[model samples]
Every structure is written in C-alpha cells, then in structure tokens.
Target: MQTSDFLAELSQLTMGFTPVVDPIYGAEVYRFLDLSTSNTIIDSVDTSSAEAIAVYIDTYLSKTGGKVAYGGYLEKRSIYDRSLYFGTQEIQLKRNIHLGIDIWCPSGTAVLAPVKGRVHSFKDNKNHGDYGPCIVLEHTIKGDSFYTLYGHLSRASISELEIGQEFNAGETIAYLGEPEENGDYAPHLHFQIIKDLQQNEGDYPGVSSLGNLSFYKENCPDPDILLKIESKVKG
Candidate 1:
C-alpha cells in the first residue's frame, strides 16, 4: 500500500486507542520521556564499564520487576557516510539520525494494540542492551503486508499471546516489561514501523549506525505518521 494510504489506515487504528493508559504503573507518578530533547542520541549508559552497565540494568529490574517498557539503546548515524557513526564523537555529532520513535514510560504499563492485527512473532533478546521482550505485529492494508514492532515489553506480554491471535485496536494485549525484561534503562516503549523486514522475525535492529543509514531509511519508514500526536506526545 502507498505510504499515505497506510498512514491513514494506521491513524484510524490508533484513534481507537487514544490517551493510551499506562501499562505497568499509573500515570500520575510516572514521567513520560521528553521526545523533543529525545532528538539527541541517548548516551544514557557508561560505555566504559561493563560492570556499571550491569548494575544499571539490575537497578531498572529491581525497581519495576523488569517491567519497563521503552528502555533500550538508541543511536544517531549519518546518512551520507555509513562508516561515520553519529553520536560517537564528542565533536561533529548531530542527533538528527533518530532511527525509531520511543515511548518512555514506567514498567508493567499495559501495552494495548495500536492497530487491529495478528501476532506476527515475539522473542526474548537476552543481550544486556537489547530488546529483552519484544513483539511484532503483521498488518494488512489493501492486501499489502506491513509490520509494526513493540520492543522492550514485559515477558508476560508475549507469554500467552499466540501467533495469529487477532487483537483489536486499543485492546490490552501486553504489559510493559521492566528493565530486567526490557533491556536495562528507564521504562519505555520502542515503537517502530518497518516497510520491509527482509524476512527477519521475532527481532530486528531498531538503531542503525551511520553506515547503514540508506538501508534503514528505506526499510523503516517514519512511525510518526501513524502516531498522530507525535507533537503532543513528544512535548
């Protein structure tokens, strides 16, 4: 389907789930990660110390029981030079190369269906800075297949969700995984749009370095089109 048509259908689907309720924790105490400043590459971790990284992950898990939703690694890379990784150097780095939009919220937050579709696949990525519990949905609009990925979710999110199970837009399908279940970081949801997955299932890289900019741009379109309130949500 055309990008416009796909976006329109996605908008309709998301409208049904407006004012997404917090999945793991209640809204009042939890703070939504600011998306405006989010344009910058998130160097939240101390890359120098593996032990420190492990401790950070442990702290997130301890607080939310591994239920944080949108906690994972995000990168910014240059489109022109694939080898030149953005956000790596202290100088000449711009955070414009955001690969995916993230929804940072508390763990255990109930993650609802953004659109009506079937459970395409899921997996437990055990790496320290990866999507610990992730789910992907296959959607068909006008006979063309597209996919949406929800990364860094609670393990329980997919424990009972079976492949091919039909989910209605706005229906509560899973809960936000805590940092332990999610890759260690503040709880949040990594929402991504993939035009072509290249046959990959269960897991896909959400962040691409400057070297793979062209490929990611074509493969993963802008998710903001579907997330109508990008401005409000980010603000």
Candidate 2:
C-alpha cells in the first residue's frame, strides 16, 4: 500500500485517540498558527529571541484562551533562515517550508507517544536552531511500517532511553526542553511522521525548499493525521 493509503487507514483506526495526555484531556485549549498569511503575527515575528517567540505564542494563546499553539506542516517560515543549516552560502535554494507540526507550549510539558513503537534512533542535535534532543520511533500498523520523530525534547527524556525501547500509545516518552537546549527556540515539540528515513538516523530534515515540496510532502505526511488536533484549533 502507498504511504497515503497506510496513513488514511491508520487515521481511521485512531480517530478518537489523544496524542498528548498532559494538562488533562479536554482541559487545555489550542491555537493554530497561520504562517502563510502575511497579515497574521507571522510577518511581525522577531525570530531572533526565544523570549519574543514564546511571548508572542503565549499572548496569542491567552487571547484565544488556548493553552497550546500548533500548526506548520508545509508552511514556509522565515524563521528557519536563522539557521545556517537552512541558509548556508553553499546551497542556492533555502529551506523554509516546515515539514512537521510544532506544538508550542511551556518547557517540561510531557511529550507522549501517539502509537506503539520501538526506538529507531535518538540523538542530541546541538546545533543552533536544531532539534536538540530527538527520538525517532518505528511503528507498524496494519502490517505497514512507518516512523515518527519527536524533536526539541529535554535531555532527561532520553537520558536513560535505549535503542529499540518500546513504548505504548499515550506513554510519556519525552518532555519539552528550554530554549537553551531546544535549538535556541521556544519550548515546543516538533512531531513528524515519515514513510522513509532515507538512511537518516535520529535526525531528518524538518524543512525544505519550495522546489522540493512535492518530495517531502509525500515522505512526511501531515502529522495531524495521527494527532487529530486540527479540529480543536481555536478559530
């Protein structure tokens, strides 16, 4: 079966599941970030200060009565330009389009597994504007295998975690890291689903140029298919 077909079946199988169990079910609120819109806060973002980004997200959440800010798949963000990994002189086309759903919340928030999976790999990507501590899980549903990546997690999350360790759905796997450790950005979880790793270990490209959108889109499907948080975003 194709990746899309596999994901569609998985979505149906997990329609009512909750990806995040922290802050209690139905107790917390969520806000959606529309980076594609020029009139929105995306255009006014400083992108330099983690404090500024946190404050912007917190302010938006407060105004919208949300506890978390989420969204980003396929959305091109100038924020990625802050990292040389995306804007190096050697590369002609810059990678600004996000390939995952980032859930912005307070540091130390519990990051949970949405499905049963085994640890495929883990790493501490210490580069500025990088994923920081990351963990990739390999999962098989309906006899089809795929991988899920959790990024921007605290060191403690994987301090004792070993390769091939298994975790169940809703199991606490990691916690959000502070700005100093989470790639110098606000505390958030960069969650992505990949049909293929391209031999990449704990790290994978979370952003790509517009010219490569088609390829990345096919490889990294919308994570909301698993999280099911899109409908809960505050309008």
Candidate 3:
C-alpha cells in the first residue's frame, strides 16, 4: 500500500475504548506509555505485587456495564518463562525480552472490536506459561490488510468464534480470559498488531531479540497510535 493510503486506513480503524466507570483508573498510565515510549512496546514490568495485580484484574472483569477501558493492545509476560523472565545478566543474555502491549483488566472483561474484521483463527495454547486461549482477527482498513491478535482470554472466548465469522466495529467479540485460562497470570488482554503474520495464527511471539529488533519494529506498529491515550510519568 502507498504511504498515504496506509496512514489514512490507520485513521479509520483506530477506535477509543468506552470507559466503564465515571473516573477511569488507568487513562493517565495509558497516556504515559503512549508519550514516553517512541516504539509503543512496554517492557521491564515488575510483577512482584501479584495480589495487587489480581485485585485490579478482578474489578474490570466483574463489571456489568457496556463500557470497557480503551487501549490499543493487551499483553502479559512471565517470570517463569525463561525467554521473558527478568533475571541475572547471564540468563537474560540468552533469552528474548518482553514484547506487545498489555490491557490490564479483570477476567471475563469483554474484549470488543475496534473495527470490523473477520475471525482469523483461535487456539488453546494450554501450556502453563503460554497464552492459554487466543484469537486473531484479519481486517482491511481503507485498502491495506492487517491482523490483530487477542491473547490470554477465557477459553469460552474462542469456543464460539468461528474462522471467517464477520464482526463489526464495537461488537463484543470475546471476553477477557481468566487467570487460570490466561496462561496463569492475573487476567488481562494481550493485544498485538501485525503487518504480516508470517504464516502464524492464534499465537505469535510478541517479543524478539535485540538483534531482530528492526524486523519486529517494522512489522508491529505501536497500537496506541489508534487508541489515542494521553501519557503522564510517575516516580
């Protein structure tokens, strides 16, 4: 696609989240990520406060309101997964880093469509530290075709999503996968944008080595460009 066409297409599909509460809790944090990070990928997360994180996830998922937190991409990483776990330099030297944007929310939280698209694939990646249940959608904005991956969702999220099923913009496509089904972490949405899937579906390595950074950089654009959240930094 031409550069101008791509930009125009991007503008069309980019949709904002309909906040579920009167005072959205994380809008400022989402803004911070957008403004502070040029690349749009978040890394170096501290997961030590597991209890606090779990509570946050529960709150979002338990809501009955139609509104949901708006963000571009959802993501998670594992301290047990050697490739992403932070550890001694010796261990980190051999493994890849975390990649993709995480939409931290509660389990059962409804993950809606930012734009119209077709179901690409679904998978039950049942490993303990893997994306337990996942879905991918292929969309054409303007004239360019691209894909978005929704990872770490409840098993039921993918149970009824048939390949090629058409979903309209703002439709509720899937609910947030619970922690048990979502690769054993606190519930959240792992959203990623892919220019080319390279024949992979239902799952993709959001992270890549520093050596292959250029490849991921070009293929995966920052999702927040579409989400439009303002950013603020805190110490």
TM-score of every model versus the real structure: 0.67, 0.92, 0.70
User: Candidate 2: TM-score?
Assistant: 0.92
> Which run of 10 residues does model 3 get worst, by summed lDDT?
29-38
lDDT of 1 by residue, 92-172 (tens): 333334566666555777777666779888888876657778888888877888888888788888788789988887777
For all candidates in order, the CA lDDT equals 0.60, 0.83, 0.60
Error of 3 at 88 (Å): 12
Models sorted by TM-score, best on top: 2, 3, 1
User: How many residue pairs clash (N, CA or C atoms closer than 3 angstroms) in each of the candidate models, in the order given?
Assistant: 19, 0, 15
- lDDT winner between 2 and 3, please give it: 2
Whole-model lDDT, candidate 3?
Answer: 0.60
Q: By TM-score, is 1 or 3 better?
A: 3
Error of 2 at 215 (Å): 0.8
Quick one: how many clashes does candidate 2 have? 0
Candidate 3 Cα deviation (angstroms), residue 89: 7.2
lDDT per residue, candidate 2, 1-235, as tens digits?
7766786776874655365536463524767766553536666878878898888888888888878788898886778777786775334367888999988888999988888899999999999899999999999877777899999999898899999999988899899999998899999999999988888898999988777888999999999888878654421
